[model samples]
Target: MTKKNKKDIFSSKNLNKNPSEKNTYNIDHVLDSVFGKEGTKKRELNRKKAMVLFRAEDLINERKESGLTQQEIADKLGKDKTYISKIENGKVTPSVDLFYRYVQAIGKRVEIV
Candidate 1:
């Protein structure tokens, strides 16, 4: 029934750190701690990978909403079910053209904002 400050919500409470210590934790801090600093190679790579995973999840939801199965999408794209599965699982990154094909195959369209 009380509001927690952002630091209190994101601090190292699970790590057994002293609650009295000043906590500067936020999303950026957590990302830097887990994936290295922004602009570093590790962080940059992780950022790209994260984007790919997000897009994959979006495609998955869109396909489900459209009432299409992975095999059906694969049929539309002339690919095997495993290929679509790989993309959804983040084991594959489709090219821009292929990504657009995926969106269209699921009865969706891409719009630039």
Candidate 2:
């Protein structure tokens, strides 16, 4: 795997491009060029990782909507506030146990599909 396949969700060119520019490349072309062609192992893994990050973002939003402070969640989970902060800020990935506790902290439950 190339270094890019490991970390980039989009090429730097795409990220740095001006939104007001007249033209942009097709998303499929950009993704394929950055990660790999569709069905490649790296592409699949990158997509899954992207989904995880998206879910982590959703978790942060949901927690905020629940009106619970990070400190309060940390207290409920018997962890330090930094633990919650780390997870919500995308600095750490929550373990399954932590994920459940997070959902439970805000009066929600995880339903595996």
Candidate 3:
């Protein structure tokens, strides 16, 4: 067997470069192509929607992990089950304060930096 050169193995040319630089579809490129560029109204709107959906999914996962149901969380928050359902379904985006309450209700804590 031949001796291996660590430098050669760790060379920049041997490293995985960014996919967009290789003319591949990175998420930014795909989003820009499909939803217009960042700062544009369409892209901004979509970005906000995506963030809400992500938070909604995270809340759902957290609730499930805490072994709690929507009704339980709703009870903790003194809200209706449908309210939690709406938030988790991404049909509603709660304000920051409400979102913090939801997180707390799910037995998770978020510290604002």
Q: Which candidate gets the maximum lDDT versus the true structure?
A: 1
Decoy 2 TM-score against native: 0.67
Clashing pairs in 1: none
TM-score versus the correct structure, for each prediction? 0.72, 0.67, 0.68
> Judged by TM-score, which candidate is best?
1
Winner by lDDT between candidate 2 and candidate 1: 1
lDDT of 1 by residue, 16-54 (tens): 444466653335655666677988999999888899899
lDDT of 1: 0.82
- Scanning candidate 3 in windows of ten residues, the lowest lDDT window is 1-10
- Using lDDT as the measure, name the better of candidate 2 and candidate 3: 2
- Please, what are the lDDT tens digits per residue for candidate 2 over residues 23-107? 6444675667766789999899888778878887888888889999889999999999988888887778888988998999998
**Residue 101 in model 2: lDDT:** 88
Give the range where candidate 1 is weakest over 10 consecutive residues by summed lDDT. 1-10
Number of clashes in every candidate structure? 0, 0, 0
